[model samples]
Target: MALFSGNQKNTAQNVYTNMRTYLAQKDGAVHVVLINSFSQLANQVFKCDEKYTTEIDYVLNCMQREGYEILDIKFNSIPNQGMTGNRTGFNTLITYR
Candidate 1:
């Protein structure tokens, strides 16, 4: 089964350690799929920093390393929902097909 680590801060060393644990255990036996979006990355307006970018890339890279396919979607505008869709959240979908 796929698992999501609750959003938390991890030191550089801890990130690496957790990744190693996940990879060593998954080993291609299960279809590991990490679903995330460019929108998610762009949403960190307040926590904007080098560390944020690095951590985002780290998770993405780890997902890639685990043979998970990454699909990026782009949206032109927000839908009728009363929410800030400026980050492209309105244009993404994740499907196994």
Candidate 2:
């Protein structure tokens, strides 16, 4: 993946930026998913993946309870051995609505 030169921080920034724009500019339900692709920082001390996933869940659930629709749910898994570590060759897709 030579084409990739970014880190979790960059990915997070991009996600928030895009999401903010999407929510502000559009008036509809938003489908979100966080694949195992960013397993790079999955094991960090703060467990950022878990935190983000939790936030997504809270928001989605709240929205759903309020009569909004959530097409997808964020995941909560530790597919990576370590945050700064690297691994590949495995594809995990867990779906929920």
Candidate 3:
């Protein structure tokens, strides 16, 4: 189970800023589950069935640019639908030095 706290916008900046705070509480590799539960980070911030892939991807990219290494990513792919049929993509782990 993952926990996300924030009512901020769905912008990468907002998400990234919040992520920094979340990461600050951790020491070493961190386990984060960016699934449907964190949909506010997506472009469709309301009345949409889109996953947080884009938003999460944005954060992931931010992490990479900051010299963070991706330890693992465990997500399910449903054909040509990334977040349409079954919204489930909770498979990513990040490690930073």
Write down the TM-score for model 1.
Answer: 0.31
TM-score of 2: 0.29
In terms of lDDT, the poorest run of 10 residues in model 2 is 87-96
Residue-level lDDT of model 2, residues 1-97, one tens digit each, is 2122334345645554554443422246344434344343324354334434443444445445645455544344444344444522222232223
Sorted by TM-score, highest first, which candidate order results?
A: 3, 1, 2
- Estimate, for each residue in 1-97, the C-alpha lDDT of model 3 and write its tens digit: 1133222225656758766765643356555534333333343335543335455667778777876666766654333224453333343444443
Instruction: Name the better of 1 and 2 by TM-score.
Output: 1
lDDT of 1 at 57: 54
lDDT of 1 by residue, 26-94 (tens): 333433323232333344366543433454556556556756664552224343332554353232232
TM-score of each: 0.31, 0.29, 0.43
Q: Higher-lDDT candidate among 2 and 3?
A: 3
Which structure is stronger by TM-score: 1 or 3? 3
Decreasing lDDT order of the candidates: 3, 1, 2
Question: Which pairs, if any, clash in model 1?
Answer: none
How far off is residue 28 in model 2, in Å?
A: 8.2
lDDT of candidates 1 onward, in order: 0.41, 0.41, 0.50
Residue 58, candidate 3: C-alpha displacement in angstroms: 0.2
* Clash counts for all predictions: 0, 0, 1
